[model samples]
Target: MKSRIHPVSRPVVFRDRAADSAFLARSTVDSAKFTEWEDGNTYPVVDVEISSESHPFYTGRARVLDTAGRVERFERRYGGAVRPLR
Candidate 1:
């Protein structure tokens, strides 16, 4: 196989503004800001709006819609028998 050329992967910081969380990972993304990590090393900082820390799915803050209720309402109005399909 031919030699593969890709962007250099370096240690970078991803910060979630809403949850005030940050993590260090290797990425090729560029950033203008830098922050000192626990290891006493500076890495490029990238600000993000959402992350696992603040995401509704990850934090269990998501809203569950009443879709089942809607289905039941439709069935009642249409008078359809509920059947179980194998």
Candidate 2:
């Protein structure tokens, strides 16, 4: 273990902008912004673009592309020959 080389980990707030959600956790990150949390204590606020609350994968809101259907439609319209793989 090194002595005093790493930044101090402290309580910080991560705010998910898309989901309007925030959570407190210890982090090595520093911020000039501050916000009062529900605990009635001020914590360094870090704005995040995406988090589990709003992410498509985590929220189950992702749109699955229908590549196979599109390919079949294209084959029907253009009659393009797709060579079978060996």
lDDT of 1 by residue, 1-86 (tens): 34567778899999999999899999999999999999999999999999999999999999999999998898888765656698
Candidate 2: TM-score? 0.74
Cα lDDT, all candidates: 0.93, 0.95
Number of clashing residue pairs, candidate 1:
0
Worst-scoring 10-residue span by lDDT in model 2: 76-85
**Model 2 ranges off by over 4 Å:** 67-86
Q: In candidate 1, what residue range of length 10 has the lowest lDDT sum?
A: 1-10
Off by over 4 Å in 1: 1-4, 76-86
List CA RMSD, all candidates: 3.6, 2.7
TM-scores for every candidate against the unseen true structure = 0.78, 0.74
